[model samples]
Target: MRIGILTSGGDCPGLNAVIRGAVLNGIKSHDFSFVGFRDGWRGVKEGDIFELPRHQVRGIAKQGGTILGTSRTNPFDGENGGPERIQATLDRLGVDAVIAIGGEGTLAGAKRLTDAGLKIVGVPKTIDNDLDATDYTFGFDTANQIAVEAIDRLRTTGESHHRCMVAEVMGRDVGWIALHAGMASGAHAILIPEVPTSMEQIFGWVREAHDRGRAPLVVVSEGFVPEGADAAFSSRGVDSFGRPRLGGIGEVLAPLIEENTGIETRATVLGHIQRGGVPTAFDRVLATRLGMAAVESVAARQWGTMVSLHGTQIHRVPLRAALDNLKRVPAERYAEARILFG
Candidate 1:
């Protein structure tokens, strides 16, 4: 059988690893030929593709980003889009099935195509770890490690300058990255989207840390909003998915903390750095396993399903399960982390 693969949405650390895993497993175990779609759904809609052989995937497991490239293009929007056109393109290319590796938006599109009788499988890929059906996703571990390291460095500089440091990490709708990184890096305070915090509370933490002869280190998710705010801070517009582009919350918090507590403060937005570079060992293994399972799902003709990590094992579930609800940080978990706050 011949299969097509594409990686979509924002690029993540373990994307190349997933491609390598699928191509190698499908070729070796299933004797399947592979083709790659370039730049996510746009490639599928426009019929842009290239051949994938064993050698093309060799030595890419540790690499960051994706070999097939990616984009935010919605598959249902455009002149030559939707299931009918996509199916025709697949038939013309002689592809039997598709394995889409990406976050929520990409998988939703795959589900729609599958509902229209297309043969497609999904592999969950997100650094936010927000998909509800899986215990964890591949890129989250790598992104967490990157955020922790950056926060650790920021702590030292903050101590040297006797200033309060605020580090912003990426978390659009969930706070997994900020929660884990802040805890690991010994941050005095952690602000997340799940819990709205008042400026008085944040200023109290900063002042308390300073009174103890310590430089206050604050870690915040990009989606965090102050208690009285109408919404998360977002200067940039929405993406193709119609979701608001979230950021600059840490910048908004920095000045407030300095002004309220009379402490010098600086803000550092980690930005895309968390999405780049080699993936961690944990992410590499998880991504590889998910990719391999995706090929197996294709072999089984499991349309509209996605490979997910439940506990220590890989399993397949309906794509709708993953899209049902976003896995959010529980209040108990946030409370446990809050116990260590200044």
Candidate 2:
């Protein structure tokens, strides 16, 4: 069987591990020939691909990012869009199945292709850990660990300068990254997009920390916004794909907290830093498991299904379950962090 693979959406730490695991396992066990798409769905539509073999995947487990590359190209737009072109390309290449590794947008496009009669298997990939149905995605642990280290480093500077530090991490609608990292780093306050915060409440936390003679460390997700506030703080504008350009939330929150509480404040946007670098051992293992399971899905001819991490093992779930709703930070989890907030 000729199988095609592509990585899409934002880059993450464990992407290459997934690709490597799939290629090695699939070739050894299933004897499936593989082709790697150059960039997400665009590669599928344009038939931009390279032959993948076991030798090509050697020594990539610890690497970050996808060797096949990625992009946010939404194939659902305009006439002669991705679905039609993808079908044509598959026919031309004689590929029997596709393995899509990406976040929500990528899965949605793959689902559409499946509905249009293509055999597709998905592997969830996101630093945010927001995809439903999966207990945890590949890069979330690594990204959170990276964010925790950044906050730990900032703590020393914040204490020395007697300033309130606001560190922004990644998350669009979910706060999994902020919540986990904040808890790990002992942040004084953690903010997320799931819970809209007011300027008054924020200042209160900073003031309380200041009164205690300790610099306040606030961790926020890039998608976090103040209630009744403009969205530009989190996004520059819409892209060609119509999704907001998410970044700069810490900058916006920093000044507001300073003005409200009269405490010296700073903001550190850990933008792409969280997505780059070597993945944690945890991430490498999980990504490898997901990739191997994804190959099994192909061998089993399971279309419109994705490999998911459920507790101790990798499980196969319907694509609709993974993409139906974002798995957000639950109230209980947020409340646990709230217990330590100043």
68 Cα displacement, candidate 1 (Å) = 0.5
Q: Stretches of candidate 2 above 4 Å error?
A: 78-80, 230-232
Q: Considering every candidate listed, which one attains the maximal TM-score?
A: 1
lDDT of 2 by residue, 266-292 (tens): 999998999999999999999998899
Evaluated at residue 37, the lDDT of candidate 1 is 97
- Model 2 TM-score is 0.97
Q: What local lDDT does model 2 show for residue 86?
A: 70
Span of ten consecutive residues with least summed lDDT in model 2 = 231-240
